[model samples]
Target chain A: MTTQQEFTDYQIDALKELANIGMGRAGAKLSQVFEHRVTLNVPNVAMVDEDKFNSLALKFETGSPIVNIIQQSFIGEIEGRSAFIIGGHNFADLVNILGYEEYDAIDEGHQKEMLMDISNAVNSACLSGLAEQLELDIELTNPSIAAFNTPNSALKDFFFKQKHQETHQTLLFEIKFFIKDINLYCDNIISLKISSLENLRNALERLL
Target chain B: MVNEEQFTEFSKLLQELSSIGFIILDRRMNVIFWNRFMELHSHIKSEEILSRKLTSFFPDVNEAWLNKKIRSTLVLNNQAVTSWEHRPYLLKLPSTQYSIDDVDFMYQNCSYFPVKDSDNSTIAVGIAIYDVTEIAVSQKLLENVTEQALDLQEISTHDHLTGLFNRKFFLDQLVQDASRCRRLNWGLGIAMIDADHFKSINDTYGHQTGDDVLKELAERLQATLRTFDSLCRYGGEEFALILPNTTEQQTRQVCERLRECVDKAPIISAGREIPVTVSIGISFLSRNKSLEEIISEADAALYLAKHNGRNRVEQHQAE
Candidate 1:
């Protein structure tokens, strides 16, 4: 549960607006690259209390079965950890949708690599507001599998352990991106430090 | 020596003496720097290779793939890694280790790191390749041993002559199939098959002819049974079968069919035509019954079939 006092309604609204803009940019970039129709929806933003950090992890995985959580850290004007939570009824279905041959698609490792490829494309375009940080290279860590086929309790414990002592407050956003043509549906979750959220709010307000 | 000159010389020595290979490539796939390790393995010196398009002379380098990896590294401003299993090597070099039949070239795990300019824009990609032939060889050997172990396991559970399930495997499946039938509320039929007048055949013909008759009989009976039916060589001139999902009625039809199949033809063995027939006994799986009781019932039925006639099917009567 998020404490209502940490962020005003206006600030939360600004974060959602910022996410919508980022989603638009991501959809455009992906459609241009893949030559497929893409649909993106606005994300939900909430200020998570340090006490509720464990519960926050379960919220990200509410609609998910066992999924692969790919983590990529970004640092710049506004920094946060981005995640691609990919799970489906059948991974072979996803492999077919991605157009991998039967010789390669049936393998487990290749399936994970497929997740990484699509996740990287979305993370680069949507998360961290990467376009604004052009002058300097934003140190985006290579995507790593933070957890694989993990249960909710373990995932929550992982999220709790990743919380650093210096972090004052955390903001969580749940976003969805869909490729309409092939039904490539995926959910993304990102968390930003309160200070970075402040910087992002100021930036979005200037645009407003 | 001056301090700066000594530092420069030490850096040069480290790059040249390293066991792994290293190369730097600009955005246009032009060679920027080739370390001593690369030069020694590739046998191309600095002068001839510097600033030259790597793909121009090196046919081993996959130009299209190398560019894709480099482009991803540059665009994402992140590291790109490849395992030897996924791709054996980008630049093939002859194996320096002791000769192995399957391994003639070095296996490599390569990493591409983005090299940035003063303004933090990626201008080049630095690639590091490590030799992993030893690891690959060990993994292959391990796989071969595992496959051999599986083959050994296969041999232990089959009859040496007929290649059918042996007595031990038949017992294992009997218990498992009974429990499964009880759990699923289905019927289970057990049959004991004995070739009639088998001792006379062995005494009349040679032992080899007798063996040939058994082999041919096994093949004929096997073809007549359903795929789910399990047949095993119980002992000399005798067989046991576990027929799952078969009621008493279906069991009679199946056993009668097997009896008719063997009765129809005389098996030709070693230039001799030997007439053969089999006596079959049947029992049904009952609720809350032990496997021993079911098998004993089937055995009693076989004894009855031998008493009444030589080539017929008999069912144990319920007491």
Candidate 2:
């Protein structure tokens, strides 16, 4: 088994560089779609478990149901997952940007389809960049969704199962990016285990 | 191992290993070849249901419909498929194991495909059942959240009385527009308006007529202002306008037009012809001033216009 401390420093550095590049691409795409200037910022990154992830997501305190696109992949020996979260407050702006009159009578199937499309585009762009940098052929699964209505504890239950199984800690990288007129927020997170570091190092050496 | 009894046992094991449920029925609709899954799901033992007419085993099954579908499949020499939208047959499943109240069993999406022989004749109907309860529940939850969000938004952004943008929304727009102007160096104008002696109109003709007066004023303001300009109910008997890319002089002309428009028509409210007029105060963003300071100056100018005389426009002159 890979140790948690052995992977922390390297993963943090790799995540920052990866987010800087990936979010830049996402920002450009959103700017073109919304026809406005967009600002992408990566203020911080950290490796956290389920408890910390839940507490951190709650601090944002958005009024609407949190819409997230989760894309999973296996990079080397590590499991990689990236999620792009859009808060409820930004729903109308997104709807208007997509050329809808109003979100008054939006149906569930339509919302799911839209979420799936957005998640697919953003995750493909960002994760593909990460894979390119790490020099790994990462296989990605179809995106899935999760939502939170109130500040309920159940928000973290789904992600906790993986954290509890392994003694070796996972790498959790948090990135925040935004575009101006559209108010696009790309909260991208990448996670992986320590055993995958050797393959990642070999890939990086090959790239160099 | 090669004895006749052992050969028969091996054939039974081979029949049970298949994933697809295989059921053989004679022309008289006698049940035969019920697999393990079919027995478990339908709660009908092979020994008990064998040689019994399929319709007799499950009394709810429509014999006429089944006969018609079977005939069609045999004539066409192709496998006939039926979707969940069309109910194919009612199976005698264990009621305790699959309750109607259970979401999974409540909405079963099953497909019925006909099994055909080499000679292109219908042999049996294979039923494939899938549970889509989770997808349906998730879809409903998403709809509920969206509907609740829209309801909350409508309550927050609109004025209860006149259906205009409320004062809170107007302030928010002022702040947003101010920031945009600061960045782009664009000009913006703010107009403060008060209905001339609105209190006496309410006292004389009653509050109902007063409400009609407010609604009429809102409609006229909407008509007179440009589409880009936002007119909001600032408070009781007062309204405000936020005009982007408009200088003080241009805003003054807009205000003058609005003033004349209101004075020319006597508002007809609840069968009462009420003569109404309004005082207007205009202010534009100074190069260094914040939105709040500009609004205060506009309010001061409105005070000046009301003091001098009602029904006229006054431009704010910062000291």
> Each model's interface RMSD (Å)?
4.6, 19.0
Per-residue lDDT for B1-319 in model 1, tens only? Answer: 4576887796587567659788889989999878888888778887899999988867866565466556656655556566666567778887777767668888887878888765898899998889899998898799999999988877597898988899999999998988898889999999999999999999999888889988988999899998989999999999999999899999999999999999998999877789999999999999866899989999999999999987999999998
Residue-level lDDT of model 1, residues A1-208, one tens digit each, is 3335656798678667767776776676556544577666655777766576655565653355666777887788777787787663336545544444555455766666556656676677665243442222345556777776665455666667667635646777777778756655676777776566557656655665
Q: In candidate 1 chain B, where is summed lDDT lowest over 10 consecutive residues?
A: B64-73
> Worst ten-residue run, lDDT, model 2 chain B?
B80-89
Pick by lDDT: which candidate is best? 1
Cα misplacement distance, residue B54 of candidate 2 (Å)? 48
List of chain B TM-scores, one per candidate: 0.53, 0.52
- Interface RMSD in angstroms for candidate 2: 19.0
lDDT for model 2, on a 0 to 1 scale?
0.65
DockQ of every candidate structure? 0.06, 0.01
